[model samples]
Target: MTQSMFRRHFRTPGTESSSAVRPLRASAAAGPATETIASYLNKRLAEIGVRYVMAIPGDYISDWVETLDDPEVNAGLVRVHPNNEMCATYAADGFGRAGGGKTVGCVSTTYGVGALNAVQAVAGAYVEHVPLVLVNGSPSVAQFNSQRDQGVLWHHMFDGSLTDLRIYEQITRMAIRIDNPALAPDLIDAALTACITDSRPVYIEIANTLEGYAVAPVSGRAKLKKSPIPQNTLSLDEAMSMVLPILVDSKRLVVLGGVEVARFGIQDRFRQMLKVLKAPFLSSLLGKSILSEYDTPYFSGTYNGRNSQQNVQDLVNAADVILSLGVQETDFNFSGVASADFNPLQPPGLPLQGSIEVRMGAARINAGLTLQDQGELYWGDIQLEAFVGLLQEVVCEPSGPAMQSLVSQFPALAPVQAALQAANGQLPNAPFPGLSGDIWSIPKLTPEQYRDQITWDSFKSLLHHNYLTSFGNDENQDAPVLLADTGLTFYNLNNVKVPQNGFIAQLAWGAIGYSPAASYGVKLAQMALGSRRRVISVSGDGAFSQSSNAIGTIAALGLDNVVFVMANGVFAIEQFLINAQAFNPQSKTAFAPFTRVPETSLWQWVKLAEGFGGVGYEVTTNAELADVLEKIKAGPPQPAQPNGPCSGSPAPGCCTFAPDATPDVRPSTFTLVAVRNVCNDLPSNTRWKLG
Candidate 1:
C-alpha cells in the first residue's frame, strides 16, 4: 500500500472512527465470534490493565496502530506517541514498575530500527523484573516471502529470516511472531500471561498484512489472572524443612530481601513476616523501598554483598543466620565475596555462617561460570510468593520453638534510627525517619555557607545534607516519587529514604538514559492509578542528554515535577572508574585521554529545558540553586498573561506562558534545575561502589 492508502486508515481524532478496524463491544457474545488480530491484541492488552501503549509512528506499524480506538477494541488501552522508540520503551517500563504489579505497560514500534532502539529498556525490564510487552510490526508476509525468493527485501532486514526474533528471545520471557493469523490471538494471550507471571518483558511481532486478518474474538475468554508459581507442594515442604530448622536454633537471624519482593507483589507480606519473626532485614539495591524505611523499624539499609558500606557489612557479618529471599546472582549483588558464601553443596561458610538462599522461581546456589553441580536442593517452583507465606505460618501461627528463638532477639538490636545516628555516613539511612520529619534534625543549610566552585566529590556532603530534604514533603499529597537515573544518583537516593515503592531505576541494566524517559511513564501510570505524588527525577548530565527528548512531554503536559541534572560536564561515573582504573587502582593513570571523559562545555542545559517547554535554571553557585529550589517549593509562577500560557515555552530573556490575556495569570508548568559541579574528583570506594 502507498502512504496515502495507509493514511486513510487513521481518521482525524475528532472525525469518524478508523474504518480499518471494526468496533469491538464489551459484550462480544451479542456479535460475531471473530475480529481482526489487531483488535484482539489491543483488547487483550486492555484486559491486563495496560492503560497506555507508548508508541512511535511507522509505516510498518500503522495498521496495528489504527486498531487502537479506546472502548472500540477495549477501554484503557490508549495510544501515546512518545519522542522516540527508546523513550517509548522506557516510558512503558516506568509505567509497569510504578503500577505495583497490578498493571502492565505495552510499547508499539516498527521493525528493526524501532525494535533495536528499545533493546536496552527491554533488557533492563528483564533483569530487574518489570512487566512489559513490546509489540513490533514488520513487513507483510508477501514481502518476507518475496525476499526468500531472492526478491527485494525490506529496508531494515538482512538475508536471515528470524534475526530480530532471535535477538529478542535472549531477553524476553517469550518472543513470538504471528505469521499465522489463526494462531495470533492464542499466542498473544500466552505472551501477555508470561509477561505478568514472570514479571519480565515479552515480544510479539505481527506482520503488517496480518494485523487486520480476522481471528476469533477473545472478549468472552478468561481474563488475566496471576498463575500459580508452579512448585511441587511436597518439594516446597521439604525445602522449608531444611531452611526452618536453622532459623529455630539461631539467635541472630537476618533476612536479606531483594527485588523479587516488590516484583511479585509480596512486599507487604514479606514485611509482615519480618515483623512476626522479629528479624532485621536489609534490602538489595533494586529493592531499596521493599519496605518503608520510616515505617519499618527493623529494616536495615540496602545490602549489595561486599559492595556494602563498612557499617552495613559489619551488621551482615554479625548475623548468625542469613536468609536471602530472591536476591539476584549478579556481580553487582555479590561483588566476589568469596566462593564459600555461595557453595552449591555446602551452605555459606562464614559471614552469615549459615545461608538459606531462595528465589521466586527455583533454588540454585552456583556461581555463573564456575559452577560444579546443579545445587538443586528441592528444586520445584520455589518462589518467595509461596515460601514467605508458608514460613510466616511456620513461625507465627503455632508459637513453636522457632517463634521463641525469634522473640529473644528483638528489642535487642537497636532501632534503625539509632543505628543510623551511630552510623554517621558509614551506612545509608532514611533521611527523615519520623512522620513529622523530626528524627535526624537535618539542617536547611544557607546557600552562602557553601563554596560556588567544587569538584563532584566535594558536592556530596552538600547534596546529602541540603538537597534531599526538599523532597518527600509529607506522607500522602505531594509525596515524592523518585526516578533516580543511573550513576551516583542511585547511590544518593539509597542514602535518603525513598517513599514506599517510590524508587524506580534500571539498576541491573545500568542504562543511563532510562529514568528520564521512564519518569514520564511513571507519572502517566500514577495518574491512571489515582496517585497524588510528584515525580522527582535526578539524572547525571550525560544520562539526561541521552534521553532528554522525553522531557518535552513532561513539560508540555505541565506536570508539576522536578528534574535535577547533576551537571559536571563529563561522564563522571565512568571518569571515577577510570581514575581508579575500573577498580584496579594499580593501573590508575594521571588524566589519560583515552579513558578520561572529555568534558563538554557546549549545549547549555537551560536552553535545552526551555526549548522542551519548561523553565530552566543553570546554577554554578549554591545560592542560585537555592533560589531556584525556593521557586519550586513556592509552586508554579503566575503566567505573564492571565488565562493561558502565553508561550508556555521559556525563551531568550524571560520565562513566559501562552495567554488567556490576563497579563498576570497563566497555566502551571514544570521546572528543570541544573546543578553544575566541578569535574574530575575521584570518588571513594572504587570496587563496585554505589548500592
Candidate 2:
C-alpha cells in the first residue's frame, strides 16, 4: 500500500487527520461492551494529537503496554521506549513545547519507582508551562484492597502506603487516581482539561486492574472544545483606560515579550500590537524567539537586566513607558545570578512605575502619575489571545505621515531602524562590520584562525554564521533547536536569530542534560507531523555527560538529529560565577570545589557516540564544523539495517533489539559533533556581579 493509504487505514475513526487530531465525545448509547478502558485511554490520547508516547516498560504497566503494542487496538499512537523515565518525560516535554502549547505530549510510567523517577522532569515542565499527560500504572485493585484492608505488602509499594499520587500533587497541576472504572472517562477528561487549560503537566494513575474493566460510555458532552477563558469587559476597559494614554503619550514606548507570549500562542497578535504602536521591542531571555528577529522589524535584542547589550539596556532604561506582556519576572529572566540583591516586588531601577505589566489573566498598570492610583485590572481567566486581540482592536493607528513624524521624534529609533536594514542585508557574504549593533559584534577571524584556535568568541561567531547563512528566514524549513542548561551556551547563542517558536530552552528550571534527551522527543514529534526540520541539540560538556546515554536511544530509533557538545573541560558557568563573586579558593564551601569539574580522560564523547552506533566527529576548527553542518543540512543519514529481527546484538547499520522493524523510509542518522573549547573561557559581555 502507498504511504497515504497506509496512514488512512490506521487512522482512528473520530480523528480528522493525523496532524490535527480532535478527541471524540463519548456516546452514552454505546454501551460498556463497546471498548475497554485501555482502548478508550489510547483513543483519547490520539484525539489530543498525541502521535507518540515516550515510555519505559515495567511489570505493572505490561497489560497497558500490550494494548499499546497491539496494532489493531493502538490506533496510530506510536510507543517510544527511551533509556530511562527521565529521558522519556523530558522528551514528552519537548514534544509538547514544540507543538506551540496546543499539542499535549503523553508519557506512561509504572507506579512507585517509575513515577518518582519522572518527578524531576515533570517539575521542569511545570515551571516552564509545558503541557504533558503523565499516565502512570498503579497496583491492581485487588492488590491495593489487600494492602489497605488486610495490611498486605506488594512489590514497589512505599512503606505500605500508596504515596506516589501524593508525591505528584506537588509537581503537577492535577493528580488523579482512577479507583472506580466507571468514573474513568470523567476523571481522564478532567485531567486532560486541566493539562490543556493550565498548560502544565498532569498526572493520572490507572490501577492495573482497571485496564480491562468496563466503564460507562462517555456522554456526548465530552467532546473536546476550546476551554473558555473568563472575560470581563469592565476590567478590559479599565486596563485600556489606564494604560492606553501612557502608551500614546510616552516618547519612547517599548514592549518586553516573554515566554508566555509563545506559550499562549499569541506571537502574531503581539507583533501586530508592536506594528500599531510602531515601537521597538525586546524579548526576555526565556522568551527568545517569541517573535522572529529576522521577520519583525522592531525587534531589538534580548533583555536580561545587567547582562543585556548596552544599546538594549540604554533603550529600555530610557523608555518613557514599558509594556510587558506575559512576562514572568523570575530571577533568571531579570538579573540571572545578579538577582541576589535584586528586588522582585519592584522592577530594577523602578521601571515598573511606568510599566503596564500583563501576566496570567490580569493587567497591572503603574503610570507614575501623581493623582492616579496604580492598581491591577483583573480579566478573570482571560487568555493572552483575547487580551492581545483587544489591544489590536482598541489601539489607535497613525496615518502614514503621522507615523513618519512619530518615528522621527525618537533619537533611539535610528539605531533600531539601521539594525533592521542591516539585518535584511546580512547575507552569507555580508561584511561583519556592516552589522551595526552591540549584538552584531561577532569576532572577525580568518579560516585558518577558526581552525587553529577554538576560543569562546570564535565558536559563537561560527554558530551564528552557520545559522544565519544556512537557515536564513525560512522557518518552514528550519527545525527547532534545543539549548542545554548552561549560561555560557545561552548568552553566546542569543545573537543567532531563530524563527518564532523555533527555540527551546530550560531557562526557568535550568535542568542540565535536558537538551539531548528532549531532542529525541522533539524530533519524533516533528517526524510524526511530517515536518522536514532537522533537530539540533546543543549541550555543554558537563551537561552532555549527564545524558550521553540518550545517544543510544537516538541511534536506536534512527532519528536524524545532531548533537553538538561544547567540550569545554569544566562547568564554565559555575567557575565564572565563583570568580565574579570572589569566593575564597581555600574555603570549604560547596561552591569552591564544585567550580572545578573533575576531568575524565576516559570519557571520549566521539568514541561513546561510535559505541552507540552513531557517526561521531571532533570539530576543532571552523573548517571541520562547516563540513559537519553542511552534511546535516543536506539530508538525514541512511538507515542502518539490523542483522536479524528483534536480536539484542550489535550490527553495523541497525539498532539492536529495535522495536520497529520497518525503518523510517526517510533517511535517519545521528551525529555527535564534539567542539573543543577553553575550559574557563566565558562568553564576552557576561555580567556575573549581583545588581
Best model number under TM-score:
2
lDDT of 2 by residue, 659-682 (tens): 743233222279888887765455
TM-score per candidate, in order? Answer: 0.80, 0.83
Quickly count the clashes in candidate 1: 13
TM-score of model 1 relative to the true fold? 0.80
The root-mean-square deviation over C-alpha atoms between each candidate and the true structure, in angstroms, is 8.7, 9.6
TM-score of candidate 2 against the unseen true structure: 0.83
Runs in model 2 lying further than 4 Å from the true structure: 1-32, 217-219, 336-350, 367-382, 396-441, 581-591, 637-668, 687-691
Give the clashing pairs for model 2: 640-653
